[model samples]
Target chain A: MDTIVAILAAAIVAGTPLVFAALGELVTEKAGVLNLGVEGTMLVGAVSGFATAATTGNVWFGVLAGMVAGVLMSGIFAILTLNLMANQVASGLALTLFGVGLSAFMGKPYESVTLAAQAPLEIPLLSQIPVLGPVLFKHQILVYVSWALFAGVSWFLYKSRAGLVLRSIGESPESAHAIGYPVIRIRYLATLFGGAMAGLGGVHLAEFYTPLWVEGMVAGRGWIALALVVFATWRPARVMVGAYLFGGVTIAQFFAQGAGVTITAQFLSSLPYLATIIVLVFISRDMATIRLNAPVSLGRPYRPD
Target chain B: MRTDKRITRRITGLAVGTALGLALSGAAYSQEPVKVGFVYVSPIGDAGWTYQHDQGRKELEKALGAKVTTKAVENVPEGADAERVIREFAAGGYKVVFTTSFGYMNPTIKVAEKFPSTVFMHATGYKSAKNVGVVNARFYEGRYLTGVIAGKMTKSNSAGYVAAFPIPEVVQGINAFAQGMRSVNPKAEVKVIWVNSWFDPGREREAANTLLSQGADIITHHTDSTAVVQAAEEKGKYAFGYHSDMSKYGPKAHLTATTHHWGGYYTKAVQDVMAGKWKTTNVWGGIKEGMIKLAPLNPAVPKDVADLVAAKEKDIAAGKLHPFQGPVKDNEGKERVAAGKTMGDEELSKMDFYVEGVQGKLPKK
Candidate 1:
């Protein structure tokens, strides 16, 4: 039972970064823009966040720097795809390549540098509950912030008036534009938000998850998060579930190996990716639901004459 | 017309004089610096495998100064990109090219064949050609010593190893560590977890934590990050660092480390190439050759344990002690080495099984 709790706690910790990145991408797609540069944005975020925290000795400043870096990265994507009418797919790929090289170059000086471990924030009274308290309440501040982000994103996307306009624009940008909605501007905002979220996720990895700066340290988490957004069928709640499910599988595989399971390590290592895809595919099998959730105008370059 | 001819002749004379003077100066300083190139599989992050090789490159530069020039290209992937980088160095007139990763073995050989005049040195690889030589350190020697420390310090009598892959190099470290642990405390056991990546800190940390939660009070890793050491520090568990001294990453948790020093060997290889006496020998150096050294033990280690490790290290250096000495047995109770025999390099290179005291079966390919 204790081991299960430990695994759950670990899953939450691992899933928080993915939650941020996928949710951010979902918002961007909802605005009819497909910014596939989440990987690159996250890389920039990880380095800038780490560099700031290392120099300033303040982690919050690092977090701010990461988000800003991510925003700036996505802003380039916005200008290219939105203003210049460049192919969104090509631009996103370029962004990832650019981010990979840029982060490695920027992170050269800060390699192997360690930071003070981020302590878990225990919620008073609530943290005293038996198994749930330890699993849910005892996590780094960023983990809790990820939950808040989910709540805010859910409210913003479904419960708010602006969300309806955003959805309409995603479904039919032409109709929305005809109705006097600022299509390009709204997309720019959504893409920028996605970049910020990706950056925050990167910062979470560098500052809170590993607490060290290394080149390519964000690894392929950005790509995983991007996949999470899709496999969740573009729903905010499903994204959260997919992220935690992925994280849970990852930790469970390691635990299985430690417990002397004879499964091949290579297969076990790939289990997280496999499990997440399988579970998400099974849940979102209805064609109608997928079509309804997917933004119709996603990845289309929008230029207002 | 006569004056024009005279002026042109004077201009030609001046140009020739300058050319002759420049040629004379170049001849006087005939010894051009030897160009050395390094191809790394990963970035030379502050510590780890690539960083140590980079350190060796720095040593070569400092030692030779004006007589040598060195260039290192880091983060070269292992396949086609590695071949391209190696070929580039050879074609660019680098006299000595060092490919510092096991995956670069085939590419190094292929490039060496194309540039027969250039000398190529590949690290941790067995393949060698007329121009391609191999060099590796017996890191298992140092692992055994660190294992001794872990065996003594662990209150739970079980240790954890976060490994990158099931390659022979990593497998040797795990087996030697278990052997060293059991040599002192027979009840001590080791649990192995392979993260399947050389430098993913997030996964490495997760593996370390999983090991710690599974009742392992001491931990170590063969991956290219300090994540395991840092995890041990955070969890208040013991950890042994690999490739470099990671005491700084885990001031309290680090018991010691098994560090690799390629500086001395790299210097010798370059010097041999410069003298045109380099051979196609596979060099595997250990404690005696100053290729592997144990990092200083933590102050918390018991005095008796530290002294015992020091004595054992001396025995290893003097060829009186072997990590895989007599009576070695596989975890399956198979006799790997007879009571009076020791495992040789050939057997060690193909190691794929766990030795006694290690918990879990080796994940088969």
Candidate 2:
């Protein structure tokens, strides 16, 4: 029982960043922009956030730094896609390469420095709950904020007027533009938000999870978050489940080694990544379903005739 | 007809001459700075491999004054992109380029051949050319010293090693450490956990915690973060560091760090290059050479414990001791290093297994 509780606790903490990133990407995709720069943007956040937090010894500034870093990188993507009329797919790829190289350069000074990670906040009654207290209520503030962002993104993408237009643009950008909707402006904003959220995910990994700075510390979690979006079927609620599921897989390696089943340990360590590929393959099997649900103008650039 | 044809050819020649003039002027401003470029597989702040290389670069700057100028593009992909960055630096008039990751070996060689005048140095790689040199720190010697301490200090009779990729460097350290541990405490066993990444603090910490929970009281890591030390400290376990001294990360948990000093080599290499004596050659430094040294022992370590570890270090340094000094057997009980026969540099460089009492298999990579 303790092991199960421990695993769940590990899952929530390990998976929080993935949950945050997937939610952000879900919002961006719902608005019809496909930014494949999630990995690059998150790494920028990780390094920038770590530097800021280490220099100031303040967690808030670290998170802000991460958000700003993501926005800045995402803004570059926005300019190429919205203004320069570049192919969205190609621009997103460039954004990733740029983010990765830039973050590595920027993170050079803070390598190996240890700083205080974000501490968990305990709510009075909820914290006293038997198994759920530590699992759900005892996470750092960012974990709770990620859930709030999920709810907020879900409502915005499904219910609000702006949400409707964003969805319509994703469904058919030309039709939305014909009806006087500003497709480019809405996408730029959504892309920036997605990038910011992905950045926050990176900061969470650097600040709260490992709680120290290392170059390439994100270690393809941003890429995992991208996969989580597909696994979640582009739904906010599903994104949360998918993130924790992947997170659970990350924590399971410890349990597997402890169980001592005589498996080569390296293969056990490779489980989460292997699971990611498996999930992607399973989800992509139904081509018709995916095609029907996928954003129509997903990676297409629009130019007025 | 001949006169008309000559007139037409002269007109064409004048047009081509104007284009040639523009191209020559474009090339004139390219030599403003003497560029030095670094291509890295991992980022510099990793506190493990790349961190030491970056320190070497800094040393080059101090040793050469303004004669050297450097630029690095980190996290470069191993193949074609690596060639592009090296060529870009070479074309940009970079006089010297350092490619500091193992995977960058072949790509660096290819680029060095193209830019024959540029000097190139690769870290921990075998491939070399007339203009390229290969250099690697003898980190295993220090690891063997640290192992002596681990063997003496472990109350649980089990020492854990958190490692990066299963490259020869990491593999050698693990094997030497196990050998050193067994030499002192015959009952001790080394358990290794490979994280398969150069620097991921999350994975590093997870690996550390896993080892601690599995009853490893003492730990050492070849990863690029203090996360392992921090994890060890959080669990009140003993640990050793790599690349840089990480005592600061886990002040109480740190036993001794097998610190790699690149400044000595960097300073020497840079000075020779400036003096025009920098012929490309492989430079390997070990315990006696001061390139690899142990960090100061933590106060919590017992005095006798420190003395015992120090005595082993002295023996190795003074040539009275050799970590691989014989009667070594592979996992299958096959004889490897013969008794009383000290392994040579070439042999040590290609070490492939644990010398018995190692609890895990050497990952075939």
The residue-level lDDT of candidate 1 at A140 comes to 92
Least lDDT summed over 10 consecutive residues: which range in candidate 2 chain A?
A254-263
Q: Which stretches of candidate 2 lie over 4 Å from their true place?
A: A1-4, A105-109, A122-134, A155-165, A174-185, A254-266, A279-292, A302-305, B1-47, B53-100, B107-122, B127-134, B234-236, B263-283, B330-335, B342-347
How large a fraction of the reference contact set does each model reproduce?
0.67, 0.36
Per-residue lDDT of model 1, residues A145-199, tens digit only: 9999999999999999999999999999999999999999999899999999999
DockQ-derived CAPRI band for the predicted complex in model 1: medium
The TM-score measured for candidate 2 stands at 0.81
TM-score of 1: 0.96
RMSD of 2: 7.5
At residue B175, give the lDDT of candidate 2: 81
- DockQ score for model 2, please? 0.26
Q: List the residue pairs that clash in candidate 2.
A: none
Local error of candidate 2 at B255, Å? 2.6
RMSD of each: 2.8, 7.5
| Each prediction's whole-model lDDT (CA) | 0.92, 0.81
